[model samples]
Target: DADRNGFVMGEGAAVLVLEDLEHARARGADVYCEISGYATFGNAYHMTGLTKEGLEMARAIDTALDMAELDGSAIDYVNAHGSGTQQNDRHETAAVKRSLGAHAYATPMSSIKSMVGHSLGAIGSIELAACVLAMSHQVVPPTANYTTPDPECDL
Candidate 1:
């Protein structure tokens, strides 16, 4: 049997099927929410350390919102790239707050990295999968090992 808490590196592959709104409608398929926008950014400041200022991340969020023609307040859920590392967690919190302002406190955010260890190259897709699961269940996954909350990083 696979140990649930044991730490072991593993590898796998997965695929997803996506259809445009018009295509799905024409096929009489039920829609599971639309993916309005997506954006990616690199932490060039440090290999492992994320910038505390979060300018790049904030810009990325803004670009995504603009592309989708939706304001930050319209985002019901934010699937954070929660890497569980100190810098990542703090920076992500700051980024969200900077982008969403007062709404950040009201919005639900989570990181699947707590349930599953960071999967380097596949992190983005894995995170998206967790987001879909959360949206479907209407439940946000808790941030595991969050015993002590950092005051500066409170969401």
Candidate 2:
């Protein structure tokens, strides 16, 4: 309980090859899939604390979905950037619900950090790999070490 804020530190790196569908097809390269859209933004709310409602992260998710020309219902799984921090976990769950509305409850969301620990910024690349693997296998990886869901993180 005391270590709820603690995270396991890990070391790793991942390199992704991104190419346009037409370009990959023209070159006869085996394409994993096309990245339809993406978005990024910084929350000026606080250094260590998030805003009360996690609106900024929700905005990022909404923007990404808008860019992809997809609705929240289209999303089947969410590869969360779960760092094993209680605050972050709750905030992220709130953000997902805010952005996806009702779809958030139906969609499966998981954090890979529980398995490999927190890699800091490098976790993004590793998570991307996990996403690809999930896609290839058509399975959603479970949140390791998770017993009971926190009421604060209903999503």
lDDT values, one for every candidate: 0.73, 0.82
Please give, for residues 1-155, the per-residue lDDT of candidate 2 as tens digits. Answer: 21456579988989988877888899999776667778887776778877647687888888999999998889999998777677777778888999889999999988888888888888898899889889888999888877776777775
Error of 2 at 92 (Å): 0.5
lDDT of 2 at 34: 69
- Model 1, total clashes: 0
Q: Candidate 1 lDDT (Cα, whole model)? A: 0.73
Per-residue accuracy of model 1 over 59-126 as CA lDDT, tens digit each: 89988898899888998988877665566666778889988999999998766666676667776666
In model 2, the Cα lDDT at residue 72 comes to: 89
- Candidate 1 pairs with clashing backbones: none
Return the lDDT, model 2, position 58.
86
Over 4 Å off in model 2, which ranges?
Answer: 1-3
Largest lDDT belongs to which candidate?
Answer: 2
Backbone clashes for every candidate come to 0, 0
